[model samples]
Every structure is written in structure tokens, then in C-alpha cells.
Target: MEKKIFENLSKICKTINYIDDESDIIKYSKDWRRRVNEKALCVVFPKNENEISKILKFCFDNELKVIPQGGNTNLVASASPSKEKEEIIINLEKMNQIHHIDTINKCVVVDSGVVVDDLNSNLEKKDFLFPLEMASTGSSQVGGVISTNAGGINVLHYGSVRNNLLALDVVLSNGEILRLGSKVGKDNTGYNLKDLFCGSEGTLGIITKATLKIYPKSQNYFTFMASFENLKNIINFYEFISQQIRFPITGFEMIPQISFDLCIKHKFMKKSFFQETKNYYALVKIQLHHLDEAIIDLLEEKLSECSNLYSEIIIAQNEKQNKEFWKFREDLTEAQKLEGKLIGFDVSIPLDKLDYFFTEGKKYIDDILKDIKFHTFGHLGDCNIHYNLIEPDNLKNNFYDYEIKIKHVVNKLIKNVTGSISAEHGIGLLKRDDFLKTKKNLEIELMRSIKRVMDPKGILNQNKIFRN
Candidate 1:
């Protein structure tokens, strides 16, 4: 970078906040997946929207690209700069703030930099929660959540960030602040712009703040861990809950035998919670406003009657046990990192096609990889499956080779099943080729048109989503 350019950026933000350290720049440029560790020109921390505007205007004038980043926890490499071009990173972690908490309307307005868990913690004071619960909640900021449209375990009942997001405040490429959506519960005046930006992956603009709907905190929870002999029975049990269960089902998660065993082997879980193990295990949890003993008796009796569908079932004895069950599920992702290379396929398949997809998908993986393993799971209620392929540590240079073949086969199967290439994770640089391969010409043109209109110079997060 030229001294004059650095001086100009220093004028926009404090000179001290502009991080030019090579090591730190490399760290900020990398994604959570340990992929694409390219260096950024520099990383700037803007304190407010005005500073961000000035910095963006500066970049636009200089024809330099900008990568707006939050917690930098996305698996698709969206938050980091591409290796093709030298872009400056606009890290938003310094702007963390909770602007308002509207209890009457059950909504909270917060800065995009506020961590999801921190927002939920503050909402707990008013007896409410943000409802978006992910393994990365502790580090993921609200802005990135909105940018990626993150759908976590609670999507069974609460839906994704797109569903909970009420409004957004964004800083455009030309130093303009664009505000979309209203704080009110209902608004149908014109085209919905908030949804367009919800999963934009920061290509359109930089998200500065958000207004999200919050649900009242549940007082009691009924959690169960069950193993299924027949994978088809999992879908059947899901239907039964939808039609029969009265409680709000927050989480219906599927854990394959490999993932369950991996979690234990890595010590992410202290021990096996199930007495009798099967091919797959599921964690079903319901939230309640208050405890009702009859509710417990009804669920227990219901499980006993439906024993034919499942091989083993264990109801959580208390809140501690319930959290333990959830911890096991949450810890599985971390354990995958320690085990080997993981390629996550976040696909949304129809409920009836899950068994077939799993069977056929595993057969293909096994046939090709030969000695590979799978660390896969899903939010079963919404049929959002995370079909992850784990390549062994001894693959060496072969990991990249296997990754290409695996991605090709898995994407083909997803396309055959009429499922989307991406479910919760948005189209980032990692999935750009696959997204373009699956996207229709009309859809691609529409996105291109929107991109041109929003970032005319294409200075914001260049070389992402749409390959330039």
C-alpha cells in the first residue's frame, strides 16, 4: 500500500485501528474451514457507520475492493478476501452494541457486530431469546448471521435468521446508508428488500445493524435421545410429532453413528448416553412455558407405544441432562476438525427422499473413496441435512483430489433429488462453481443485474458469489 493511501484510510478511521501486521492480516483473511488463507492489503476497524461510509467511499474512489467481515466464522469463505485480488478487510467486531430492546413488540434492535450469544444473554434479562442457536453462536456476530441466513438447530420451530430478521441497516458501496424493512410486526407496502440482503453474503453491501424478532424464553424443556434401527422410522417419528405433539419442538436433530462415535472418541462427549446403539441417533427436544407432569407421562407412554419405530429411547431426567444431550450434538462439529478434513454439504431434501439420499449418497462415497468415513448430521425437522465427507489424515496431497470428485458426485445427487445446492450456508467463494453450475441462466442474470445496480464498480467483496 502507498503511504498516501494509508494516510487517507487513517483519516477515515484512527491510524491505530488500521491493522497492517502481516500475521494479523493473514489471520483475518482466512475462513473457519482453514481454506484460502490469502493476505488482505490491510484490515480496518471502523467504529461507526460514518467511518465505514468514509472508508468505503475511499475504497470506491481508489477502485480497491472491500471485504466486510464480522466474526469470520463462515465455512464457505465469504468473509475473507480472495487470493486473486488484494482487498482490504472491514472488520466490524469493534462496533458491537445493543441499541434497543423492545419488550412490548418482542423485538430487539442491535448492531450487526454484536455476538449472537451476547445478544441472547442480554435478552434473557427480559425473558426472551434471539432463537438462532448454532455451534458458532458464541463467536458469530448478528451481521454475518444475517449475511449467511444461518439456520441452526432451533429452525425446527423458530426458522432461520431470514425468518427472525425484521429489518436491516446497510452501508452501500458509494457511501450511502440504505435502510430496509420496518420495526413493526407487519409491513406489506412494496417489494421485500430485507430478504434480498439477508443472504447476500456481503456482496451487495455491508450490514451495519439489524432488528430481529425474539421469542419468550421457555421455562421447561423435555428432551429425548433415541436410536433408530430403520432410518425411515426417523421421518415417520417426525410426522407423528408434527401431528400429535402439543409442545413446541425446537430441535429435532439426526446424528449418524460415525458422528456419535467420533464425538466420544475425541472426548467431546464423556461417554455414550445410549444403552443400546443403532445406525443413527436423534435428539428431540420440546420447549414449554411451564412444567406439566402429565406431559412427561404422555411422552413416555407415547415412546413405549411406538417402540417398534425405535430401538432405544432415553428421556432426559433434568435440565442438566437435557443440556448434556445438546452439548453432545454441538460438540460434534468441533470434533470433526480434530479428526480430519471435512467437506460439508448443506442440502435441503424432501422428507420422503432422506433415506434414499443417505443410502445412495453413502454408497457413492464408499465406492469412490474406498476407506473414507462420514461425519454427517442434520436438523431433521426441516429436512436440512449436513452430509459431510471426511477424508483421512493420510490423504496428504490427495485430499484436494478427492474433494473435487466428492463435491461433483454429491452435487449431482442433490440435483437429481431436486434439492438445493445450499440450505443454510450461502454461496461463497468455496461454492461459487457449484452454485453457478446449478443456477439457471435467468437466476444468474437476475443476480448479476442486482449486483451491477448495487455495486456498480464491484468494489465490495469482489470475486465472490459470482466469479468475476
Candidate 2:
């Protein structure tokens, strides 16, 4: 049976490459999750749509499953294969191509596997911006971005990946092509299928291509790093900023002092932006287009009157300094990784309930474990923060062994605050059971029904987004 399956795969993916080597097999076996190991029988690369269709048909006929992968940067282990080894990995990197950028329509039609940073630069050169900027933009692919409906720095203004995607070209589980939505905005169809597949995380179908909406480049953008004595003060400043300006307030990131120290210990920064006097801080962006300095005056006035902000760092005496400030925030993630192995989660809660979630959640773990440290920071604008628990300092220690127990405590805390297990990272295996715990039985049944209607034979990314 194995020999016959490989033979059929070779025929369908003739123009592309196939790797059955030991190292190659191991590379595709897991994602960044590293919590569980999943091995794929063979990894197949298809160059185009026709080749993908043929490969899917072959897998369907043989009663095999295919996990579609791009960049392999998923945090929730969504792209990683199951332990069954009954699946073949389908990588979309070969299809990375931007076919057309229609400036008049304010959209770009691109092949699935294009990198986000590459797309961003391409659009910027043409005086348009894709506006989806994440830490993994250099490695994360368009197909995965669209499938996961990724949210990043600019989500406060442009919204998540789902809001930017105008259309999608998908391949269903039964080897059928689906073209939903279009470059045009208004689509009051029978059902909004594009939205459905945007966050489906490849369980429903494989997104091969997409038409994404772009915005005109912002004329003026400024970044500020403000220090607060506590998380409560940080929340107050957020409320103040939300009410003050109506223009594009692109990003508002909250960084606790612990996470900040982690960055510094790893040599992420040399001369600090502000004096390290407070336990908490916020990195904010205010985008404007005008000749008046009134907005800046108003912002400064608020900072002064609030009595919460300990200090504020406005780097840009000129435009050059502002750009430098932006670069510092973007590079923060890379700097953290240079230090040690990290375990983190993407979580969300109500904006007003932020204080309880962070304070109570941290207290719960810190009380139990005295030696370990947990770092918390993320998009305060959209209410999604990354709660990372760093491994113990000892090199020989195994940090991942405590994942299940730690996650259980955090999940319980989030549930108490009416929050979700996942905010941006989709329900890959890492959080599949957690997601199910939060949803009702009927909701799970509905999702299953949708899967059944779309992929009757259960060939596309089987045993993902749900329990087997």
C-alpha cells in the first residue's frame, strides 16, 4: 500500500520534487509547537494548481490524509502532522508568486505561498501597503496567513487578515476547486464563504491563492514608549488614547517589566528608551496626516494630566528617529529568541477585563512555582496578548514537561474571566482540546457538519481542528 501511494504521488507531482530522506522527513514532522512529535510518511511539493488537484485526488482515492503546510511557523501545532503517519505533507512554497497588483482596485492577487514581508515591500514600492505586519512576516506565508486570519500590529487600523482578504481560491477535500468572493468589496451572497475559510486553518480546504485589499500608504506615523507603574495604569492610558484620537492609531502593545528584562538580558537593547523606573510600559503608534501639531500637544497633555505615566519616550525629533523607533519594536521578538528556549500562548479577553486576566493569571502560577518566570506582552489595541513561560535557567532542564499542567491552570483562569484559549493562533493540536472545552456541544456538531458537507471523505487535513 505504501509503495502504491508513493508511485501515484510521483506521477501527479511529476514537475515538482518529492523528498523521502531521513532529514527531510524530520523537518516536516513538526511545527514550532515542539510539544508533540508528528511524522509525515513523505513530503510532496506541487508547483501549481493542476499538480495540487492531481495529488489531492490520488490521496483521496487511497484513503490518505494531506496536511497543507506553508512556512511552518504555526504556534498551535496546526501545520504539524498527527502521530498516525497516515498523511502526506503538501508544501506550498513552490507557488509563491504575486501575479498582479491592481492599483485602481486597491488590491493584489497573489499565489498562496508568498512571504508577508516580501509582499509588504512589494506593495510599499508601489505606494500601497498590505498592512499585515507580524514578527514572523519574513517566514510566514500568505496561504497560512490567510488561513489563520492572522492579526498583527496594524490590526487596530486595517483589521485582521480576514478583513483584508477580498477573495480566496481554495481546493476542497474531494479535489474540487472553489472560487469564492472577488476583488470587488460588496458580496451579499447566499453565505459568506470567504470568512468561513479565512480562520478555518486548512481543516475545511486548502487555500491556493488570494485577492487581498490594500490601503494607501500613511503619510505620517509616530511611535511612543510610555512607562506605567502598574497594569491598572496601563489600562487607564489605553482608555485615554482610545477616546482622544480618531485617526489611525495603528498599534498599542503592552510589555511587562519581566518581558522587557528578558529582552535586555539577551542583549535585545543597549541604551534603554526610557529610565527603567516602572514595572510596566506600553509601545504605541499614532498615525497622522496633517500640518497641525495639535494632536501631539493633546497626547502630551493627557500623559501629563493622567498622573499614571512615569515617563514617555518620543524618539523622533525628526522623521528619521520615528522610523528607528518602529524598527526597535519590530525587532523585539527576534531579540527575545536569542536568549533561550521559549513557550508562549496567544490569548484574548474583553478589553475591560484585561486587569483581572493578567494579574490573577500571573499570581496563580507564580504562587505555585517560585523558580520559573512567565513573560506577558502583546497587542493591547485588540486585546490579544502573548503569555510566555520561559524555561528554567538550567540548560539540561526539560521545560516542556510541565506544558499540560500549566496550560490547564491558565485555561481555567481565562475561562473565569470569560476569555478564550486562542486569540490569533488557530486551533491546531496544541489548543484543540482547550478550544473544545470552551465551545458548546452544538457548536462542535455544527463545525463537524460543515466539514462533512465540504469534505465528505475526510481527506483534507484529517484529525486536525478536532479530536479523532
Candidate 3:
């Protein structure tokens, strides 16, 4: 059956490229999540919209499941296939091409496989900002970013991947090409389909290309790192500064002291941002292009008002220092990788309730496992907190063994604080159940209805988003 499907796919997508070996399938089967590995019957790389449409039609006609994958940087196991090994994997890497760059419209059409950082660099040459900055930007593809609606540091001002996206060229389940949305700002046309594909996680359709909105690059930025005696103070400072900074405040992040300590222990940074350790730290970036001396004085006055709340403040006086401060934030994921093992989480709570969430969450976890250490930090302004558990100190056991049990506890705690289980990370296979816990029955039914209507045969990414 698999051989027949592969032969059909090859005939349909002649433009597509492939290395059809079990070894190649083995290499592409798993995602970064690594929670589970499922073999793909075959892997095919589509080169263009026509190739994608033909492949989809072939799969639909053959009654075969097709899993479309981009960079595979997803923390959730969304891109991986089910255990059956009956699905054909459609990789978009070969389809990478910048379709169009319209400076007049301030939009760019890019293939789904273009890396986020590479896209940013391309746009930077023309003094435009893509505005999505993820730690995995170096490897994460544009299609995956749009599919999962990935959000990052700049979301506070620019909004999520969905906001920056203007239009999408998607290959629907029936192999029909869909051109949803337009570059024009205001389009009150019927249903907003662009948003539906933004975070669909490939259960709906394969987004072949995206027309993204670009912003005029801000010329000046004020980046600062401030250390606080308590995590609550950082939270408090966020509430304080939001009222003062009329211009866009790009980033509001909370970095725990142990995370910084781990960086030093691993020598992640030559000179730490702080000379002395504190309970929590924050990295805030304020965009200031038109502000003059008087406005700068007012900004300083506001900082001084919030200064008493924090113990130490390290302002980025030069562009070099600014880069260093951001590098510290950007490299945090890699720094955490240096730790023995991590139970990764991307949870969210009300911005006002973060202090309660942390205080109660830490207390509960500490009581359950006395030696447990947490490296909690993320976009504080957006309320998306990534609470990661480092390996317990002096433990000689396998950390991955406790994943399921820890997730239950973490999910319960997040629910208690009115938080979402999976914040920016979509419910691939890993957290699909948790996503159910956070959503209402009607919402789930609506999502299921859409899935059913679009994928009547249940062939596209089977058993994802909706549990069967």
C-alpha cells in the first residue's frame, strides 16, 4: 500500500525532489520535541505550488495521510506522524524562494521553507522589519511560523505571526489552491481564512507561501537590563512602566537568577549582565526614533520613578551593549540546553496574576520535589511565561522519565491560575490533551467541525489538534 502511494506521489509531483530510502525517512521522522518518533512511509519535497497541489490530490485520492513539515523546530510534536507509519511526509525545504518583494505595498511573498532569520536579514537590507523573533529563528521555517502562529519578544508591539501575516497561498485538503486575504490593509471579505491557517498546525492545509506585512525599521532603540530583589518586583515594574512609556515597549522579560547562574556555570557569557546575583531580572526594549533630549529626559525620569523598585539597572549605552543584552535573551534556549535535561513548558497566565502563579507554582513544585529547580522566564508583557524545570540537583536518575507526571502537575497549577497550558507553542501531539483542558466544549466542537469539513477523509495530519 505504501509503495503504491509513493509511486502515485512521484507521478503527481514530478517537480518535487526526493531521496527515497528508509534511512532518509528515519532522519526526517522525528521533530525537535523528541518525545516520540514515528516513521514516515516516504518523504517527498515539493518545489512549488503546483507540485504541492498535485501531491495533495494524489494523497487525497489514494486515501493516504500527508504530514507537511517545515523546519521541524516545534516544541510540540505536531510535525511528527502517528505510530502507524502510513503517512507520507511532505517537506517544504526545497520550495524555498522569495516570490515577490513589493516596497510600494510594504509586503513580501516568501516560500514556506525560508528560515526566519534569513528572511529577517533579507528584509533588513531594505530597512524593513519582519517583527517575529524566535530563538529557533535560525532553523524555523516561514511556513511553520505561519502555521503555528509563532509569537516572540516583539509581540508586545508588533503582535503575533498572525498579525504580521497579510495573506497566504495554501494548498487545501482537496488539492485546490487557496489565495486567502490580500496585501491591502482593510479587507472585510466574508470569513477570515488567513487566520485559520496561521495556527492550524497542518491539520487543515499546507501553507505554500505567505504575504507578510512589513514595518518601517525603527532607527533608535533603548534597551535596558534591570535586576530586582524579587520576581514580583519585575512584575510590578511591568505594570508601572506600561503606563509611562507611551511609545511601544518592545520587550518585557523576566529571567530567573538560576538561569543566569547556569549561564555562568556553563560559561555561556564571558561577563554576566549583573556583577551580583539577584532574585529576578528584566530586559526591556523601548523604541525611540523621534524622541529628542527633552523626551529622553522624560524617559529617564520615568525610569527613575521605577528605579526604586529594582536593586540594579544596566542601561545599554551603545549599540554594542544593546546587541549583547539581546544576545543574552536570544541565546537563553541554547544556554538551557547545556543543562543536563529540561522539561520544557510554554504556559501563560494573566499578567497581573503571574506573581501568584510563580509563588504558588514554585511552592507546590518545591514541596513535591525539594531539589527541583525552575528556570522561569518569557514575554512578561504578553503573559506568556516559559516555565522550564532544570534537572534536580544531585539527582542520578533519568529526567525524561518524569515528563508525564510533571506535566499533569504543571497543567493543574496553570489551570488553577487561569492560565493556558500551551501559550505560543501549538498543541501538536504533545499537548493536544492539555489544550482540551483549557478550551470549552463548544470551542473544541467548532475546531472539530472545521477539521471535519476541510478534511472529510481525515487524511491530513490524522489525530492532531483533535484526539481520536
Which is the leading candidate under TM-score? 1
Q: Give the TM-score of candidate 3.
A: 0.95
What order do you get sorting by lDDT, best first?
A: 1, 3, 2
Model 3, position 405: C-alpha lDDT score: 74
For candidate 1, what is the total of clashing residue pairs? 0
Candidate 3, residue 173: CA error in Å?
A: 1.6
Best by lDDT: 1
Q: lDDT, candidate 3, residue 439?
A: 82
- Model 1, 1-468: lDDT tens digits are 556777888787753222456677777878999878677777788889999999988888888888999999998899887863378889999889999999888899999899999998999998899999889999999999999999999998888889898999999999999999878868988889888888999999999999999878887888998898877987788788767778789999999888777888898876788787688888998887677888788878777776788888888998788888888888988888888877788889888887788888888877777767776688988989888877765775656677777888888888888998889988888899999898799999999999999999999888788987
TM-score of 2: 0.93
Tens digits of per-residue lDDT for model 3 on 301-382?
8999878899888888889998988888877777887776778889888877777777877777776566777888899899
Global lDDT scores for all candidate models: 0.85, 0.79, 0.83
Output the TM-score of candidate 1.
Answer: 0.97
lDDT of 2 by residue, 65-133 (tens): 888999998888888777656778898988889999999999999989899888888998988989898
**CA lDDT for candidate 2:** 0.79
- In order of appearance, the predictions have TM-scores of 0.97, 0.93, 0.95
